[model samples]
Target: MLNTSRRLWNQFFRKARKVNNEPLNKVSLIVLIVVDIFILINVVMGLDDISRWYISPSQAEPCYSQWQNYRTKTTTDKDFEIIKNSFFGIDNPLSQEQIYQQVEERHLGKVSQTCFQYAKYQEQINIPPNQQIIQNIEQKQIQVSQFEQSNSNIRAQYDSTLLEKIAGQSREKSINVVGAEKAKQELDQNNQRISTLKQEITNLKNQLVTKPESMNFLGFLQEDSNFNQVEVNYQQASFWYPSIQLGFQSLFLVPLILVALSIHNFAQRREYGLIALISWHLLVIFFLPLILKIFEFLQVGVLFRFTFDILSTLLGGLLFLISYVYILLIPIVGFGIIQLCQKVILNTKAQAVRRIQDSRCIQCAKKIRTHDTYCPHCGYYQYIECPNCHNLTYKYLSHCHQCGAFQESSHNHA
Candidate 1:
């Protein structure tokens, strides 16, 4: 086993240092290395782009996230703040009732539209009639949005005018009467306009909500059967998204790896040294991204999630122990792989058979003369005594060349 490991190490070192009989000068080697880097970068970029072809969990069920949040939590001041920041674009205080109404109206319209789109995607509903209803609601919402924006501008202008009037009164100890009255009138007109716009916006939202078609769509979305199924689909999609990405990336890369490997092998056989070298580089470059993607999948894929959930359930407060568990587990898994390679893949007798057949030194894999009793390159014994035939035979071989008898103890000498 030790001799086998040494020979394998030497073989890998030679392969890594140079491709078959192809002498690459430093400059050309650097150029090839640069080409490899560029190809690897593009492959990774292509993989990332292909991974996005599938709809993400968030995109697949946007309505579910919003609905889940709405159902799970009571309306809080933070919710009001989010609405104020997003819609009003201001930090000015507003009555809680107004904020709550706006919040409810916004969520209802958003949830209805998202659910309708989702239903269409799922092919659960007729698209034409529902599309028309969605368009109508969208148009009304747009109008309301326009009105609210205008109202915000007017309100800002009124506040500025009011502040100016107050400043004038404070500085002079007496107001500029004409300017003050003009500002006052402007403020009142601004206030009235703001009120009118708010009322119009409210009416538009109310009409959208009360419209029979809109109400029916919302009702359908609210049904336990429809909503529950959507939730289930979303959860499943979320759970499987990483696996789907990994599978797609694998599909994209496997073909490239196979093609490169085939070309490399063919080139090597034909002694097309340059083609073999380039194909070898391509094969390595292709594998780079596949390895990285696999690591990423292991970190974020379904297996990780399943494992984490199990740990969370089983350990709870002791979950931090998982870090230690992984630290130990990885080395054990690595040791098992090493043992597999040593015992099965790089078995001493198996390697010796191939080396002997190739007329190469069993200890170093270098060419040897047929009549040589010992390897010239490594100065190792070339033959061993066969117990069955009592004749000289190649060392580390499972059979004796003289009698064609099995040499089960052949590896014991090595």
Candidate 2:
């Protein structure tokens, strides 16, 4: 069994080495390798793009982090300030009362907008009552938006009028008294309009909360049902995303590998060197990404998550110890694999057996006569006396060829 396995490995290496037998073929192989690397990079990138089609946790629930902070009672005034500034793009420093008001307003607006979206999503899936609730929220939101826009316009006009009034007063000694008086009247009217708009906007916002359907939607957001479901779905999608990407990448490469393998096998049978070389390159290109993605999946997919959960549960505060454990364990594991390969898989005895079977010196692999006891090239012993048969047999072979007696020393060496 070992001899058969060794023969297959030797044949594979022999064919691979033959692929670049000539100088021109070597250059062609290098060019094909460069092409393969380029294709592999692009294939990996394409897989990444496909994986992003699923919604991420942050995208699915934009306010989740803030909501969590709020729920945990860890939201400080600094957090509210940051949120308020971000929402309104505020650059100027605000007074304490102004900061509080702006933060409260921003929070309400965000909640309302999120709830409206949730309602719309539910309505799209034909959920009863959500359609009516969505329509009501949309109407109220539009009204609030329009009022806010008008209020901004009115404030801009009031500021202009007030500035004009101050200029007119400054020029009162040189200009007409009538123009100064008119500027003052315009400023007063603008101020009154600004006050009225502020009242109207406040009234509209209050009315938005008063509506039954809108109130219910707001209540839903407050209760965390909508956000919780989205969070759960986002987590589930994230957990499976790596596996999905690996599956898709495999699907893409598997067919190419199969085709290339078939071509390679056919070419080898027919002694079509060039065809076999190209097919071998194609097979390697197709398999490289698959092997890389499998490793990637093992690191980041559900398997990793499961392993992480177990470690977290077991180690708790001692989780950092895992790094030290891996640092010590990996070298030991690698050393064991190396020892196994040296002792059993690719041992020197296995190579000697193949060389002996081909009538070559076991030490130098140079041509030798069947009855030669020592290699002429290397002066290494080619045969040893088998105790059971008292006959010379090839060194490193498990059994004596003449008497079919087991060579104990040869078996030990193997």
Candidate 3:
């Protein structure tokens, strides 16, 4: 039953995919970019809407391979280093030694001479706003329905008694009906208030959830040491903005998305194809972090903290705009380009669909990849094969373009 259900589901999805011709539509891409940009701006402005979209704030597992990852913390590191240097310059030798010991112990073999950050551990929210609200709404609605149902059941028994007391008298029946109607009206009014209150409560809860202090950024630190580190605790009995959390997560997500997109676009295309994709990603992820850190580093040199802030803000805008154009828009346009090449230029779909297993480049059998169209190394064409008879087939094949085979096969004379 499970397999059968899965097969049906897959069939439906495959058909849907074919009809769409791409994973995401232009409208979807535009919406994602618009929403992402809006959220990015909100995050920059300290609006606190970071994890609103599907992307959630993870523990920000830094990919050790990317230098950009380190740059992100560069500013914070500089702050610590400056504080450290100042301590040493003031002849506070013990404090500097303690700080170094803490760093060496905590970052041992992973981060050398890096200041420990006591950032709050945050996770991105996955529940849709509607889902979150609707869940509460649904519970209340169910309660309302249940109350009415139970009330009706009780009223049915009361009506029996009332009818008995009326004793077939028209006047008594009329009086009883009027009284019941009045009672029901009062009950309904109260119920409505309760329902309204439930809705209001849900909204308030959501509001609180989205507030800046809802998620603390202090718990993300390597908890081995606590004393003498930056005590960036969540205050107000708790604090830190969801917008920042989500927005930062979104910033992380965009590059991840772009990387995934490029991988899907050019994964099988070539060995060197990702050089461009990764390079762009590094600029956003690693370079942006690096530059911001540099500003932090030179904050002492230039004696201008605001300079770093301005540079970081400008960098954020530049990143968003570039992401919209290159990371976001490029994929939508690139999908069109792929389709155009397959239809107008080559009269065939991308060669990437042909890769079967082991990362073999479908187009030229050069490099391994997942979802690209052409062989980047040799520029070879990739083709789908008829599953039934093992003959090469076109993407839109109703029958095997090579041997007139359908996806399904029937017994035939060999």
Candidate 4:
């Protein structure tokens, strides 16, 4: 097995290093290596592009900003508290349906308002007015921020004074429930005042919206059937972008690798396992593309869409079945392929042809004289004594040339 492997390796190198009878120059080999390197780099770049698309934080920035602007008009502190609790609190956390409902009630209204505002502004909004409106919004935000800072400081001082009074009562061994109740009332009043301030801030922010921009185009698209179809197409592309990129990358990369390997190993097909080589190449070239296309088909949600509709409504479930089927079928198919290579595909005909070219080295396919017992090019033993005529004959050939008699040896059959 080791000797066979070594011989195969030698054959591979011999083909890689030469074309016809001439050795490939160092420059040509270097060029081939560089091309392979470039292919590797291209694959890496494709991966980067896919990752960038998937994790694009900026894609929703405009939507988020518009959502925030809308929230100033619609959302209150109570709504904010509910959202924060749903996210972090351990007790009575929101169910998926409840969370979605809350989001729809609060945010969907804003989304609608935003779209309506955009439609209204589209007719009248100009560059100068838009700039002035944006400036006004920024100034209102600054004022709200200053007020919030001042409110925070006042709240902190009131809380500290209440804590100190409670500690003092504890030290005196006389629990002042009246004093404690008054302190609680003051805290409540302070909270009410802060809430009033926040409401006033929201009103100021709402006044600054002189013009509105179209940000939720995706959401706005759902209102019309034509626009809804466009949304579906966009969603499909967005969903499949990564998988399609991967498939495309593999589509090019795998072929390049196959070509490189073909140049290095199958240059002299007749001299090697020609049948096995050809069959393997066909399998690789066929199956790899098919697999990639299957992945692309899956990623685009086409099965969820209408192409698979005629076949079955539950295409997604069918795909899961197909995935398991592939898992089982692949090994069986692989075993069959291995058997084909070992038994039927890699037959002795190729070796017989090589033996017919008996004047050449069996290992390297370099020309040799009939009298030479071993190949000068590859050091492969090429000649042996014929038992019938006691004369030198080709070792790999079936019939002895000296007497035209059959060579009864296991090596000859092989």
Candidate 5:
């Protein structure tokens, strides 16, 4: 059974992996983490062996023995005949196929009952179940089969296909009877509805021909005040309705924009192009994070959350496309894209340079790349003395790296 289950899982997983054509990523990682959590709960429920197919022979012995006893008793013994007909209700010896199925079900039940009994009232058994119990069960099962072989004159047999055909015909006749009754009822109901609707249709046709002559009927050409009220009610409901209720539910562009802008910003920052670096971060990192949080918060309810997720997934895709285009055009926002890159640099040295070495424009963090040394981000720069180590650095640096100290060094140095 374990082997069978493994084959099933392998077949399923192989198909999934083939369709993707690539290994899993962070999203898949996140999903698997969530799956693992549910699997842990299932493991606790003690259904693990159903998946693994590892039922012990000791557990199978009693079920196998009962199956053999019933198999032989059905052919020659009247008492066995009653038990077999009552349980399976088929006048046939138990087939190999039926035995296998019964064994599987019985073992599963035994495992579940055993686990439940152990948990419901604690008892400890240290040693493993021995082969003697399993062998005894197998011997009893063999005896019934041997007895049937020895008494072929009394033991009558019918092929499974013929037996199934007879059983199926009976079932089919019963189903046809039920279906006929249902169809007759439906036909009567539909006939009644058709008569009623025909009367209404005739009335409507007469009104269409005669109503235009009435002056009061001119109101039909104008707005119906009742319909206006319905329209207003619809508008009110639209705000709270799930995206399906709102026609353009597929086009949730906000989250898409954030994720796209973030990816773009990340790439631009890596390339050191300044525009996309800033734009990407401002839109995605700073904005997208805040947006997801707000969306999750607002959609705390299940129906609302599912609707929100669908809309958000759609919008997020479009936003990503836009972000990619923008990141190509403007490089600064690339700061936001760093999180996507497999390799992340702490860049303490570069960060130190950004903080202390280069002058940053007050309005932004753009580095002053040229000697004129005006702050590039905001174009705000001023020359300041390094009180410590006497090595001039950006005032924003706060601590002097030269002296390994917080304040500028008071002592003069070249």
Candidate 6:
């Protein structure tokens, strides 16, 4: 066992010496590192492209604005019905166009005045400080107040005059009079004006609430039933999403694993020859960029989202819960599994023997090892030292006294 271990150790140190001493071997190591870095960069860029594909520019996104418009139009239609029932009443139902016209006429003068005031304020900002900007603003404020007060006074006077005329008509001996009809007509016109103003105010407020700019993706998905069709489309797209993403991932990760294994092999074989090290590193460098280029052809994230949408539909809310839990636990579970394998299955004598024969763990085929009852690194048992020859021999093999000698079995004469 001692002899076998010494031989293996000697071999490793000799390889290390060649790798450290030879200029060509050192150059290959440097090339390998550079290539790994380049491959890593490409992987990052590919991931970014995938993200962009999934996220999509807000302006260019299909169905988003149309959904918003749909909401706005529906809201407007509902408001039309409410206004018709509340103000126009069953006796005199109004068309949408007629309601719009009445509302516009009711608010036209006031809206125009407000717009003029805003325009004047804009002009004020452009004026020089030497000019009476402040004084002009103050003057406009006073004028607005006076104008409102005067209109109120005029309305009050008209109301008082109307009441006095109605009272005078009532005082007549006979209740039936010519002026009563005129008074009734005047009151009816006044009530109609007030109703029009109220309806106009209600419609404007509703419009503000139902505007297209108010909705967002999450809110739309969560609350709005109108987006169900769009959601279904997305879900349908998701079916192919996983395959595209996995393909891209494999493109980069498979080569990365291969390159890493090659580097490890180069480290071991460096003692044998610089030619092996250089050739292995050359292969890694040659393939890394090619693997990365596959990303250019893949829209991984977009595909993923497309698939996810349908998956969500099929799985419902369970999909979201599973995804969340999986994302949170995958690393932890993976690390625990690795640790357990190392401590249990990989740390056996059979595994150690395989490692000695193959220069890698039999179970994983990823890590290198040396001869020992149990590997010092991986804790896998390999060979036991012969008591006499002090050489290594397989633990499971049967020999007379097990001297660890290389010999063929003979048949006993009967």
Cα lDDT of model 4 by residue, 1-414, tens digit: 355446556654554455554565798767755754565456556545534433222131213333333344444443322222222222435533344345445431222233233333332332344445445544655665665675566565656556757676452553333344555565566566667665665554443331133223223422354233334444555555555555555565566556645553454444443333333344344345445544555434434244334435555557556555446655675577656754565434366456446566655555678667677765777667888888877665668888988887724422
Candidate 5: misplaced stretches above 4 Å? Answer: 1-367, 370-373, 382-391, 407-414
Segments in model 4 whose C-alpha atoms lie over 4 Å from true places: 1-128, 131-135, 138-157, 166-222, 235-359, 370-373, 381-414
Deviating ranges (above 4 Å) for candidate 2: 1-20, 25-30, 49-203, 223-237, 326-414
Best by lDDT: 1
Clashes of each: 0, 0, 26, 0, 37, 10
TM-score of each: 0.62, 0.49, 0.19, 0.44, 0.21, 0.32
Better candidate number, 1 or 5, judged by lDDT: 1
The order of the candidates by lDDT, greatest first, is: 1, 2, 4, 6, 3, 5
Give candidate 4's error at residue 142 in angstroms.
5.1
RMSD of 6: 20.5
**Candidate 3 lDDT by residue in tens digits, 1-414:** 354346345533432232212345676546545654664454344322333322211212121112223234655333222212221222333543355444445431222222322211111221244235435655776776776775665566556545655675554555344344555665676577667866775564555344343333222222324321222222210122333333455475556545644553453245443343333333244323323433333333232334444555778755445334335543565577656744674331233234444455533335635455555654544456577777655443346656787744311100
- The per-model lDDT (C-alpha) reads 0.65, 0.59, 0.41, 0.48, 0.38, 0.44
Candidate 1 residues 140-216, lDDT tens each? Answer: 55665665675555555656556766666463443333344555565566567656655664554455445464455
* lDDT of prediction 5: 0.38
The global Cα lDDT (0 to 1) of model 1 is 0.65
| TM-score quality measure for candidate 3 | 0.19
Which candidate has the highest TM-score of all? 1
Task: Please list the residue runs of candidate 1 whose C-alpha ends up more than 4 Å from where it truly belongs after superposition.
Answer: 1-13, 19-23, 49-185, 252-276, 341-349, 361-368, 371-414
Per the 3 Å backbone cut-off, how many clashing residue pairs does candidate 4 have?
Answer: 0
